[model samples]
Target: MASDVHRRIFDVVARIPAGRVATYGQVARLAGLGGQARLVGYALHMADRPLPWHRVINARGEISSRGDSFSETLQYRLLAAEGLVFDEQGRIPLDRFRWDGEEAPAGPAGEGS
Candidate 1:
């Protein structure tokens, strides 16, 4: 069974929209598990659901190396399909594509008015 922390991580990742990306640290912080970047990555690595996992990158706006050997290229292709443009050095332009962690306006209990 997925731990609570992992579930939190997945929830945060699931909210990342197309054409935007969140860094590992960003997802960890957003999930209320501050500084647990590695935990976010591990949760994503094990996720079986179809998440926008490709939208999670490193703080440097780049994909982190993976031992699986296929993820890097696949991630790049996935992001590319979303119209995200990478620099010549293969890094997403964080200022352009990075997900700004903004919450929409809400009413009581954090629900939309």
Candidate 2:
């Protein structure tokens, strides 16, 4: 059986979509995990297998705080390639680009939704 923390992390990751982003706190809330945003981060940190770790960011749309300098730079490059526009300050404009997590129901025509 999956541990509660692992399940919670997976639940949060599953909700993040391509071209969108979510903060650790937002994912925790959506997973009904209360104020355990740090727990979410910890769980992710312990994960060994590959997952969409890049789709998540801070509430301010910045990368997670646990990587080397090169990793941080790579995060920015990958996000930029995904069409995520950033401001002059190198910060993603959360107000304009925040992922609202309101994807349309999956269907033939809503594959990207």
Candidate 3:
């Protein structure tokens, strides 16, 4: 079974809307796991659920490259499908897509209800 911290991270990740993204630090704070950004990354790495792992980036507004270009490319594609646009330098514009900690609407569409 997953620990409470892992569960909390998953919960926070699940709340991130499709078209929006949150940094690992942002997710840690929202999960009440403050300052545990790396922990959040570890949890998502092991999570078997459909959590929006692609929606969680690093504080630099860029995907944390796992030394694998394929996964990096996949993340970019997933976010692009959600309407997120990254800069030519592979940096996402956090100002445009960052989640504001507002509650995600209770639906599959990810719109505020």
Candidate 4:
């Protein structure tokens, strides 16, 4: 079975749609993992290479790389290519583009709120 942390992280990451972003803390809360925001970061750090690590960012919408310039640059490039606009400071505008994970309605707008 997948470890609780792994499952939580994966579930959160899966919910994040393309062209949007979610903070690690937001992911932790959505995953029902209490306030273990750092745990989400740790899990992502240990994730497989194929995982979309670049899609997750700090609460301020800044890339989390403290070193490894290549990885950081790659993250920026990938996000930019996905239509995610970044400021001159290299931070994404979270409020304007945050992904709330709400899917489109299956029918007309009158069917649901």
Relative to the true structure, how large is the alpha-carbon lDDT of every model?
A: 0.86, 0.73, 0.89, 0.79
TM-score-based ranking, best first?
3, 1, 4, 2
| Candidate 1 lDDT over residue span 3-107, tens digit each | 888888888888776778999999999999998899898898788677879989999999899866688889989999989999988899999988877643465
Residues forming the 10-long window of minimal summed lDDT in candidate 1: 104-113
**Tens-digit lDDT string for candidate 2 (35-98):** 9888877777677556666767887777866658886788777778778887776667777666
lDDT tens digits by residue: candidate 3, 76-104: 89999999998988888999999998887
- Tens digits of per-residue lDDT for model 4 on 1-113? 56877887887787676678888888888888868878888887777635667778999889997589998999889888889999999899999878885752444644411
Q: In model 2, how large is the Cα lDDT of residue 102? A: 73
Top model number, lDDT: 3
Off by over 4 Å in 4: 103-113
Off by over 4 Å in 2: 104-110
User: Candidate 3: how many backbone clashes?
Assistant: 0
RMSD of candidate 1 to the truth, in angstroms, is: 4.8
Higher-scoring candidate on lDDT, 1 or 2: 1
Per-candidate TM equals 0.86, 0.79, 0.90, 0.82
